[model samples]
Target: MEMKIGSKSNKIKYYFLVPALTVLIFMTIVPLIFSLGVSFTNYSPTRIGSWSFIGFENFIRTFTDSEIGTSFINNVIFVVVSVTIEFVLGMVIALLLNRKIRGISFIRTMFLLPMMVTPVAVGLMWRWLLNTDYGLLNYFIEQVFGITSINWLGSYSLAMPSIILVDIWKWTPFMILSLLAGLQSLSQEPIEAARIDGASNWQIFRYVTLPRLKNIIFVILLIRTIDCLTRSFDVVWTLTNGGPGLSTELLSLRIYRLAFKFWETGYASAVSWLYLLLVIFITTRFISYLYKQEF
Candidate 1:
């Protein structure tokens, strides 16, 4: 009777999971498999019923294409510089907010406003603000510093920096929230002991606080890096559309151009797969570091 009841419970649990499993297979697994298959063929919608298996040609192009190379380099710069700035700014703000000062709660709430806006909305809003003519930024600069016609998004040198600045403005709050949570959860005993030992605030933070928050730092960095690599499409698309001679084009924009703009579906699919592999490699490295630390 006991064995029969256990078997019945197991079956019921499986039954409950059947719908989710089915959805996962259809939604994620099926599309991934289809895309993988398409990556090997010279498939294009324009060629309707005339596409053929090209076998590694698309993969070869993904490696050798100069535009893809440029875009990849741009992505690396974007991920590194933006994440570093966000981390620094977030840490400073988190430390400030961790204090029990007056109006701290209100200030923290206000800091979250930028991140709460949708990416597309953020992009649209900044695009207007950064416009050379009739822009608030240019107007302020002209009034304050006698500067005029600063083309924030049109110039190759400034366009990438402008995008990075906007990204920092939007995402720094996420880092602050994460770091603040980590800071608050940390035990006070060590910090107090360090304070009693004639250690300066910087020393305590560098030696005690930073080591304790390592896990949180790693987690936020990993999450942000992956997100920037994969989903940073809408903002860049709406902001500059990878313009100014591909100066600001990241791999995602490159993929969009190949797949839709140029209709080189097979090549785009291969490039995407390579990009996924790169993400997987970085993720694995981070996981391995965590595993080693645990052991």
Candidate 2:
């Protein structure tokens, strides 16, 4: 009777888990398999019913294609520059807010408002603000510095910087929130010990606080890098549509154009797979760092 009851309980538990497992497999695994299969084929809208297995040709083209290469370079720059700025700015803001001050709660809430705004909305808002003719930004610049209107999104030299600036504005709050949480949760004992040892404020931060927060910092970096690399589409699409002659064409945007605009489905899938591999490689490195820090 005891053995029978244990078997019954195990069966009941498996029944409860089956639906969720099935859903995961259907939703994620199936699509991934389908896309992987498509990546090797010569699939496109133009080839309506006729398609053939091209097997690595698309993959080869992805690496050799100059446009894709440029876009990948742009993506690297975007990840490094934007993440660095956000981390620094967010860290400083987090440090400042960690202090006891009047209206601290209100200020912290206000700082998060930008992140709360939808990416598309943020892009549109910045678009109007940065417009050349009657934009508020150019208007202020002219009033303050006697400079003429600047073409922010139209100029090749300025367009990428403009996109980076907008990204920094929208995402810095996320870094602040993550780092602030890490800062608050840190044990005060180490900090106190450092202070007791005649360590200056900078010395305490460099030696004690930073080391303690390393794991949290790595986690934040991993999350932000993945998010920024994968989901940079919406805002950038809204702002420039990879615009002004592909000046700001990120890898994600480039994929969008290949898949949707050019209708090069198979090639796009190949490029996407390569891009996915790149992200997985970088994320794996960060996870290794995290594990090292843990041990």
Candidate 3:
């Protein structure tokens, strides 16, 4: 009997994927490896001759450093508060726009405008609008409440909250779009059945609508939480540059400051690694939840 070569042929088939995998490894794995290695040493490029292995010292410093401590706490608060507000506002917008109404398509498209704008542009535009001297925001506030020259981004107490407000303004549309898509995709069979079974609107929504929306809501929370943590650099940096005394310092902006401003590359690497770990943890949990729902 002739031995079939099918097993050998099948084993070799994966060779075709090698090139793409090689590129992926190069693009992602290499930087990760380099960053990981650098985190164990003082790898400042400007002080090449002074570099040396420091092991966990950088990580220790990250915990002990008062600056990092403050930034971390502030970042956590910002993420929680901003994400909560954004999710609530997004749900409202999604509910309102989910109905069959006149000019729905046009309104939906218009609502998406904020999400489509570049983050840098959004930041700059808000920066102008939050200017203490002449911003439109303060202008209206003064006109309505009879105040003048309120410092939106300049006040230390208000700086962080101001940035959070900006984040919500720019990103609420993201939440809205996701929720709207989920709402649109829901089946009406159960909803109609609930309505016929003597369910009130609030009861139908609470029992029928929100239950079906749990998975999507979880996904959106995970995604938006990560974005709120990492991609906040543009709005925060442009609006306050992590100032009003580090009040607006987020993880991303903190990392940028360490890496570029201070040129403490190895220390920055350690911080970057921490950021990566947080992202990985959040993403893993999200995927696990999704899988559990699927099963």
The residue-by-residue lDDT of candidate 2 on 1-295, one tens digit each, is 9999999998999899999999999999998888899999989978679999999999999878999988888888888989999999999999988877999789889989999999899999999999999889999999999998899999999998999999999989889988999999999998999899999999999888998888888888888899889889888888988879878899999998899989889999999999999899989987887777642
Rank the models by TM-score, top first.
1, 2, 3
Q: Over all chains combined, what TM-score does candidate 1 have?
A: 0.96
Clashing pairs in 1: none
- Please, what are the lDDT tens digits per residue for candidate 1 over residues 1-295? 9999999998999899999999999999998888899999989888879999989999998878899999999999999899999999999989988978898788889989998899999999999999999889999999999999999999999999999999999999999999999999999999999999999999999899998998899899889989888888889999999988899999998899899999988888888899999999988997788757731
Stretches of model 1 off by over 4 angstroms after superposition? 290-295
- The superposed Cα distance between candidate 1 and the true structure at residue 148, in angstroms, equals 1.6
* Poorly placed runs, candidate 2 (over 4 Å): 290-295
lDDT of 3: 0.87
RMSD of 1: 1.8
Model 2 alpha-carbon miss at residue 220, Å: 0.8
- Model 3 clashing residue pairs (backbone): none
Query: What are the Cα lDDT values of the candidates?
Result: 0.91, 0.90, 0.87
Q: Which stretches of candidate 3 lie over 4 Å from their true place?
A: 1-5, 282-295
